[model samples]
Target: MNFAVETPWVLAGLLFMLWPLFDDGVRHSPYPWLDILPSDAFSTGLTVLLRILGMATIAALVLGLAGLHRTEQSIEHIGHGANIVLLLDRSNSMDNTFAGKTPDSEEESKAAAARRLLTEFVAGRPHDMLGIAEYSTSPLFVLPLTENKEAIQAAINATVVPALAYTNISKGLAMAMSFFDDRELTGSRIVLLVSDGAAAIDPDSELQLRQWFKQQQIRLYWIFLRTANSPGIYELPTDSRNDNADAMPERYLHKFFTSLNIPYQAYEAESPDAMHKAIADIDRLEHLPRHYRERIPRQDLSALCYQWAVGLMLVLLALKLCEVRR
Candidate 1:
């Protein structure tokens, strides 16, 4: 709401406003019996009024040239919502249906179902500041955290594009964690991971991720899209020889998250309806009071100044026409 000028030097033109006050160069016709005329107070007042209007007109013109504008500002907002980051997996398998095959007219791909449900989730939360991050072979920063619903929806819809070959979720989680950098913890901070598959994380990366979760105190939620005939997070290998991180990555990843000692939940979704329900549950759980600042963009006022100048000039023209001549 504060005002500023782009070119301060142009304001010097406002000095021209004094010209109307001091200049008495208007021509007058000679009158031999001027001393016999009676005092005219109305004319004297009208002359002063006209000079003031002239000064105002000049001042307006100078201000218009100065590029006046309102500076950008940030205002604090409080609402019942959480700061959430949508950490999505964009691997090749996400392009298939829940049955692990290309979708036909009767079925929808996992990514499509996720995009639809997440769009609805965003629409329902009016005050939540959400960010989008996707990971395939590497993590991609899609959008920053903001209260703009349209932008969040657009980023979700764009996830339906053909995905890459691999899923490096460890790096993706790191990127999602980075979104909260320099952000105040005024409310619940949640990381919602939507993925159909999992990959093994190196020991070094795993240690770093654990430290980050401890430092940030972030809540984690994983919506596991379980394809038909695939092993679930809770499933145990029948033979003890095959129970390792590489063999059952989904289970180990879940175990790693549980050991972090932060608030964490995992939902196994085998169909579109299950995905919808999981998203709904998340919407219900993240209703904590949040406080954040929203920025307002700068607005130019030069056009307003010019409009005022034009209006005053029209009024002065009308008064000039009413003057009586000798």
Candidate 2:
């Protein structure tokens, strides 16, 4: 408890209350000889008691006027979970449903399905520290790692817009990696990347990304949304020519992630149901100890002081009413 007032000097006026102990206020009474009687001893003690109560009431009122309160403290909470980052791709191809992005279609678009399922995923995990990032031509950090489910769901909802830009996977990965900086090495930290297409990464950039992931000891999961005509990561080219390798981008991207020697998994989702299954699998795979802190705001003590003052004043009022006319 502490005072928050600008002028605490008013507290000095409380000393004046002690003056009642040394002298009674009565000046010239007609029956001055009655003060020397032995029977008046009880009345003398009562006067002292009433004076002390009055002083206490005045002191409480002064303290209340000074504005007393305590400092805010943080409440630390621990649980079992992981730090997961949702890396979503906003390429134009993702705007379509798993069947196709055709006009006047009744099926939900891939982006819409993702938004709905991710919102559900966030709602289920009360302990996990989750973050969101969306990438098109560049990466955008939608939210930082936090236990705030509402904010995370809002970021996922905002990603449902049309995807007119091209996918930049390398930059997206780089942006996701930057989030773990200065974060404590606790629990199971992982990145859940969701995308429908893949792009090539330069050899220099690939080496740096691999080394960085190894240093951080982070896990990666790619929830690949397979379209109707796109080649899957496991499918091999029918052509014998060596140049056919370039046509299978997903395979090379999967190879690069595996070469990092870190924990990694890839799931191919062909429909909305498959997408939900993939997220559930990721949920089961990533589980560990999670530590977080929440702030508890300060509370004021002025109200309690005022209550004490009011109670003491009521007692003094009762004492005065019972006093005799002498």
Which one wins on lDDT? 1
Highest TM-score among the candidates is held by which one?
1
Per-candidate RMSD, Å: 3.3, 5.9
Candidate 2: regions farther than 4 A off? 1-72, 103-105, 242-246, 295-326
Per-residue lDDT tens digits for candidate 1, residues 25-56, read 24468877877888799877877888888898
TM-score of each model, in listed order: 0.85, 0.72
Clashing pairs for model 2 are: none
Write the residue-wise lDDT of candidate 2 on 1-326 in tens digits.
Answer: 33364346876767867876775433434864764666777776877787788788877887777766665766678987888889999998888888776634569878888888888888888888888888889998899988777788888889967786788898899888878888888888788899998888888889889877987778999999999887888777777563243677788899889888899999999998999999998877676777877545677877887999999989887876775565
**Whole-model Cα lDDT per candidate?**
0.92, 0.82
Worst 10 residues of 1 by lDDT: 23-32
